[model samples]
Target chain A: MISSFQKLTIAFTVLAVFTGANSLHAQQFRPAPNAHYPNHALMPPGHVGSQMLLRGGPIPGYFQPTQVRCPQGGKIAVANEGKFVAGQPSTLNVGLLIGSPYRFKITEIPGLPGTELFPTVELLDRLHPPAGLETRFPIPIHLTAQELRMAAEGMFITRVIYLEDPTNPVVVQDDANRQRFFDVRFNEDPLRVADQLGRPMAILRMGSKQPRMDRQTGRFMFSSPPVRTIMPVKQSNVPEDQLQRAIISTPSIGRLR
Target chain B: MSKTMKTSSRSYLVLSVFLASMMGCITPGTTSSGPLEKQSFENIPRPNQPASLTVSDANSKPIHRASPAAHQQRLPAGVATQQGPATLPPQAYTGPNAGIPYPAPWTPPGILGPFPEDEYVYQGGDAYQLTNVAQDFSIDNLDEEDTIAHYHTLDGKIEIERTNRIPIYAPRFASIRRIDGLNQYRHQDHVYAVDSPLALDGTAQNIGQEQVKQHVSTQRNIGTRASSLYRENQKLRDMAHQVASTEDSQMLKPQVGDLLNTKVNIKNSQEAQLSIQQQTALAQSDEETVKEYAYDLLPYKILANNRIQTNYHYEIADGNSRLDIKKVASKQDALPGELLEFTITFKNTGDKAIGNVTIVDHLSRRLAYVEDSQNCTVESEFFVNPTGKDSAILRWEIIEPMNVGQSAQVTFKCRVR
Candidate 1:
């Protein structure tokens, strides 16, 4: 009886080990960070990259007006040469140049009351919207509650904003309230992956780091680039959830506004 | 060994094999192992040549529109597909031959007659005669009209009008100089070939010697005339130089009539005549005090007081693709003291080789070229002309010819004013 039990145990252990190996092999390959990856940390805060891009003079569709949406509702203010302004409540519609980095503050969180978070948004590229309707197809930046909470806990989070490729889209049954986003492993670069999937519009970095007291330090932290204030998008009569879905899905169709 | 020990040993062996297999899956290919900036070519089209011209920054993000209509739906937002404002359309190239076919089928062996291989033969006589031969003295080919018609101008003054005529009347002595030398030679050759004896007599040989002497004498006269013309031109050039180099105080002042009496447009069209007259009148009035000053100014301007350096880059197309180039700035706008980098991408997108590829960029007045900032994919010779106060010309010469489908990149930095 003892011998038979031992044989049974060995067979079960072998099968389990073989299954685990196969599962590991089936996993997708993730690229390792290159030597230049360290420079990402060396970059100073604010839109220094964007400010430099201005040197070549104005290019068409460069300072594309993008909308920053705090889905949970908060005071959105932008920094002017490191001075945070008295922000508008909930959403801020501002014109940001492509290849520019922008920093803005989010305060008076709806659920996390009295809480403020400073996030840097880098517009690595731009979109070609319809002629007169540039503001209509603004790049929607959704700052979710979960992301904010994690960031508040002193965790660094990076979200790559990308225009979903119509040809090959991630099929998810997401409504207006919930935008579908997936998390990659800590080692994998979300920016590279987003670029492979579609055109990466902006790179958003959210962290608990606050501005320093020194003037020069503050300048690097919160750069004041030229900003064109655009009118807020009109609130639609349709339900919030349905409206969000339509806006996101409409751009992926034949005629992109 | 005990049963439990044996089972544990078997499990360990299976686990080791599994671990080795799993290790292979975790580590990916080299493609993914790099920084985002190096590989971030969001604006550059795959395989290149999506548009003839594409301007992208150091990070490879395109800043200009390429082709609006065709690339509207295809390209990313700010980086439209089309030529940038700085890019001009390629100039039209119609070659010297134009509509005429190269090496026309009827082109004979270049005037070099039969038995060309026999170098010892006196071939210079015929060949030299072909070049030096006096053009046919015909009335039809005269540059000036033969008949001078006297007509009354609107002012009632008698005006001379040179008009073309049928030349039925006696020709001008100057117009009827000599017979066409080439025709005379051809006629003589035809007679000699048909009438020459198998062996020449002494009389015949003597006649040939006399003919040779006459030919030599004619050549000497032509050389003397050419020498005289050269000396006259030299004297004129020396006088012009002296006039130009003379001090303002030493220059002679001209009377008002000397300025007004200058005649222009002695040849060519009426429009040309009118333009030249206007220019001459303006110059004469501007420098009424000095005739030589006005005379030297036009040629001095034509010669260009400013130095102009010319360099060439040869390119050949295989009847398919062409050499395309683009310039992109790292930053469209920059602060006065900030450094900006520009990238120039050149590619030979053809089946044939392109020789001595060169790219020339003119930097704005506000930009100052940074020293030792240039980087190129292939070995190249770089030159910069700093004489321009408004702008600087940057030139990159690729020494080695680019083969089919070959591409190269050149980058340099500049500081904004």
Candidate 2:
């Protein structure tokens, strides 16, 4: 019986060898066609592999926008460059900012269409009424190149106020500063500016409403917001580049007003 | 003793099978695997034909209305989709950079196009010659709304109207000059077949004189004013039409005034000229009407010197698919302070093996120079880009040729910051 089994195995092995030899011969004997022009991989796994693997820049805080009384609202990644031609499924990641640790769910607004409705946005910690965390779904917009036009396409400013000073924990001074912030001016173009390759470019605020300008080009938004610019402020202590736009929410404004 | 030996032999056999399966039949060399069956597309619609001047004559597509007549849209709330503004936690996170978000990274998707609230707004490229000011068919507006009237011009030539602005036509038809050189030796019968643009039909649609003047002023005036885009585009249409029909066909006046300063209807309505003595509108169209076209290259042939010359006419059809850049060989990842790098791959999927072919590889100013590929005989690594995205072409002019089932790769780098 063992001898018979061995003979059967030998036969199968011979068959496999013959098949391999045949395929090899065909590959060698037959001439491959000439390579054509403009042959590209359709977003191969290797190509754009880094972007997919990282999912880094697509959204700020990586879809986890935590709202802290510490600073202004966090930024989210929410744009699409390239010509944004029709029918392509482009992605935009919006981060949610919840001030404190909390659990909440998103509820669609009563009247808005699903496509038009931005993911409901609010402090999950607060879960306030109507426009609260319950109603504010994360902003998941699916805009065609055409629908994008209807979006506000300019620069504007949004501010995040911290509760007084973190270290001193003083509500008094924060309120006063908050009162002055209301006086600041800003422009509001909603279209996010992307670098040519579609990377997000920083949006700035010109101290005054008018754009800060050298002779030819204009200044970024958020250049100023009633800060003590001349008051012994050092450059290093500042968190970000001067070109970046930023506004912090202060709790002191109530007493100041 | 014999029984024990048999049991041991069985164990040995199982072990050998396990080892064989681990390695499989793979060979050491990375030789080409899989079948040689490359899918050949038969008779793909050739996209070279510029939109017919008749496209201008075609009925204007209607604009998209977001709201129904029953419920018109009111002013939309100024809710900002500021991507960087909010950084959410990574609960169900599953990406490479799926960690905590910080100063926040700049993502391509998060980058918004033109916005009204932005302190700065910019538009470039040119409009399609046939579909001028086409809001509906714009590659930019293909998704949400679909009303468009504007067309795009082929690449290579830059036309600055009194407005001094370009519409950023699509990527396909952008051309530097009209004629793509033909195979003079092949001896084709039709003169127009060899010509990229048989006749440069100048159809200047009449935007009112006021709009023209605003363009003559500053682009700011045109951009801010209502209907300014419409007016400027109309003027351009009329200008193209006038060029197409005004000149005497028999003569190349080569002079400015040789073009008749007359109106050609957008609908191609026929009109006659009055007799020099009589106000009679003369019915005329033919060789008698001078038709000066953009330059055309007669049947000509030269060894593809391994250089890609590109004319960004920017009028590709909406149907064109995004290139598979992965097939391109040369590339760069981290750029030097101001430098950028790119690698593009292309293959000959068509039945005809391409030789002496000139390709348009779009490259912009932002990318700086590094290494280029062997496919291109000549390279332009120093091209500066005022805009972020540009395309570069690798013309198969010289060097080892390609076959029907083969591919070529190229790489380039540039400085963009």
Candidate 3:
């Protein structure tokens, strides 16, 4: 008779087999903190059957699978300390700006947000400079099913480049270029993104900046995580009927900044 | 099974948890840490959420590596890889070398190389450089067993989902060109010969109808005797003279004279008529067709018998990598150069690939030529590689490639503008 411990061990073994460190979603969409995106984006479904489908997630139904929200408004004021003062006004409430009058709660999200901070990363997500071959970090990040949906609907975070790379220009055409960026998605379970509860992150590579393990081989030497922040923007005015489906957002994201 | 002392049991458990967490061996909330440069999230909190993460021990022994290289065995735990001597430049360390299973940082398949040297890659921002795509850190000690189990939980054991196939739509077009000098010549001197029965000039000179009929009737009866002949001659001469003096007679070649200041329009009308070949060509232009319908399945689907569900998970511009099956819906907005997304569902009408799958598609020669074929069963074209997800568009230009007997589909972006 197998004991519970044995069963658990077997289950653990099975789990390891299913996880690949080099998933595009894991790296691009914050699959795991350490997982890198090896497959780029169009990876064959890791498993078969609809069981792999995740419908519900833990976020308050607002932060979707691969999306996050930082809503502003409603009004807030603090008195002398970090406490809300009832029936009294304070300086915090003055001159406040509300970006949008209304915001929709999404059950689907792409990812919460990525940071360039530390203590959460065990690796980076990047590629070599074209010498030959290089390794990237195992970015263990995965958006929940809800996040994936929101991303598909344009309700998630996207990358906007500021400084331009003459060598690599940015084109909005879907088929043009997304290989260098990390995309948020939920092909894998969010909870099991990295090892267990590992935070998601991204590494940026650009210019001649992509470090190489061996410059001769064009392998990745080092890379910086793509910097990002989430803010509110006005919703589009186009009606839903006229807009084509899947023209909304990308489930794949974030190769560079 | 407990080899260590009781006191070390907790340490062992902690070690186990740590290992599981690091490798993402298994768990519902197995998340990963970002690279050395950045943190993923900063103090994230929801109105109501699990206040704390699952507790595990951190005092466990450090897992050391005998050798990062030459292990041909398994990767070492907790040790930086040994790919180079000296410091691995700032942010270097993409992952393991080619031929080895992907160890972290290095997430790309086959080999690490620069982005395809093209405008698409160079102009895509710094993010598009092939070197820029690699992650910043490297992960190690990955066992094949781990991947298998994780996949099992997701039920991904060679069980392929409905793939978002890239349709090879190489549409061809006939060039509509213009000739430079045809319309410049405008002919203004050509004369038109305007003739009508009313314009006949011999009417006044002709004999009365009764006399003419009488002469004709008697001539037939007498069989043209000398007396009748003389009368016929006189009448014929009068008609001839009337014609010769009329305006139309001057227009005729025989009567016109060099000294006549005015000329009949007939002489120039013949030269001004349009060429027969040119008229025939214009008439045929009415029947030319400019468009054609495309076939649904250009090649074969992985399965048969089942109605294949379609998706737009794959992308074309990025060398066909990022795949998102569940979220995409049919629409023109998916991307540029894309057409329509078709979904086909098929079951094992035949045997499954079981492990590796290769779908062959012979390109329709009409639209686009084969650039190249890699892992593609057949067919290739220029500027595009026909492989797992590298099928291209501008193809349907001639016809859609759809195979009968199997269900297959793809969400494609059609070009309108």
Candidate 4:
């Protein structure tokens, strides 16, 4: 015979306690020492995972615990904090979930004349990863003046994928066979499997870094915004031989060709 | 004889003798029937005759009554006489004796009184003195004359004495000729040589090369900046034009206006940038010329011959005040965070005066000028780069002329950034 207000107050208290515990647990959880990825060396002090949660429980037709975050949920971020002075060298950090055998291709938004894209190899070196991530790797992107201007205008990573097994040790070399493999497995369109999985696999809207204010602390801090999201890729129902032919005919994969 | 007869006879004899004496006095010389004097004046020298002869023949000849017209008519051809009819003297015989000759009125001795003193006169400008005897007289008649006096006598002599003459003003004529197997009164053309001590120092060539290098680098930088600004300005202009043509919402109008304003500003700034680039190019050319001239003349070699040298030296001291000082970098080297005071001790070592002396120092991108650190005694200007680069130009001009062995110093301060 408890009053509804009292019951509501109890439930709220319980919910607060549960959320606080989860936050504390997440903070205290550290990866194993033997973990392949060294978290302590890679991440900055006080680094925190993004607070966004994906809406769907799991993507269909994709491995569970995909080890990849959807674009809308702030899994990947690009920032140029303290690195945009003109006529001096600057770097762009593209944050991604730590997954080996990954490939990405940055393409200029067509019809934008001043947009420039350096060869992908220069941007995708193994050393010099993104800032503020332990369980993630970065494609350290160096920008020329023209490329920086293009980024300011609006550029994007049109494709990002985790290759299950790459035929070539280096994806940039001998990319035609790799492109064929990608087409056969993921359909002619690279994002077809991602579309079926109902999650964004592409990102856009690169802009200058903005400062965010913490309401409780009354302090300003800079952070990159969540990447732009795209609708799931449309399925093209075609025969297997046609798909194979399409894969062979495809010119490039992740700028590999 | 009776007393009355004797007295009468004596009277008659005395009267007869007196009449005879009177006739002798009246017809002493040839008597003229006209109003002319009844005497001969042949002993009197003509007015135009030399005074030396007149003085010498003073006691030699008897005075004679001569017609002036007859005397003038007797002169040699081409000899000029005073214009108009000549008149006779009232008394032609007027000397020590009735037979002695009288002096002519137009003679030097008569015009200048009994005797004339010797006088020296200069005939040229104040800068020089060319002497001549305007008037000379000697009672002894043993005076000797030089060629200059003879020349002056032929020409008209000036009558002013002069002193304190300069040798340059002396009358001198020179011509090129082969004498003793060498060219005389000839010289090789003079060339502008690098003669300052600063130019002759071993550090000087390095300084010139360094300055040239900096000049080239600065020119390149200016060109790059101008090109970048032009491209940006063009892009902004295009963007503004596109925005203006589009029919956007009212909220976007302010943005469009801003864009247009930005474009105009950029275009205006581009003009300044291009101007700086052109100026830099011209300055580079001048620097190259200076370098070539400095290297070609080889002031060090000239210094070895003791032909050209300088007392010019520069000192660098750093301090917060005049009394408190510390040694800073030397020549063209400096460290970061140094407060440096540069004092250039400028000296003129040449024989003549030097003017329009100017010293220019360009600050590197890593230095900042100290506030109010310029010298008040000289004309100075500090110019900041219009492109917002961290470099500046400093110039000090010495307007007053500096004489030989004269020295001056200019001081300024800068802080390393």
Query: What DockQ does each listed candidate score?
Result: 0.01, 0.02, 0.02, 0.00
Docking class of predicted structure 4: incorrect
lDDT of 2 at B210: 39
For candidate 1, write residues A1-257 as lDDT tens digits. Answer: 56988999999899768655544433322222333432231144334345445545333235666777675457888775457778887678887766656778999876687678988877755543223545555666766666677677777767666665422333332222233454554434565555455555666777776766467555544446656667887643324343233222211213111
Lowest lDDT sum, 10 consecutive residues, model 4 chain A, at A120-129
Top-TM-score candidate index: 1
Off by over 4 Å in 1: A1-61, A172-178, A237-257, B1-417
Candidate 4 retains true contacts at a fraction of 0.00
Off by over 4 Å in 3: A1-189, A194-199, A202-257, B1-385, B391-417
Candidate 1 displacement at residue A229 in angstroms: 0.3
TM-score of chain B of each: 0.25, 0.21, 0.14, 0.20
Q: Which of the predicted structures, 2 or 4, would earn the higher lDDT when compared with the native?
A: 4
What is the CA-based DockQ of model 4? Answer: 0.00
Question: lDDT per residue, candidate 1, B18-115, as tens digits?
Answer: 66445322322101112432333333333323332332221132212222333344445655344532222111112211111111112134543221
Tens-place lDDT digits, model 3, residues B47-72? 22222321121112122211123221
Q: What C-alpha lDDT, on a 0 to 100 scale, does residue A78 get in candidate 2?
A: 16
Candidate achieving higher TM-score, 1 or 2? 1
Docking class of 1: incorrect
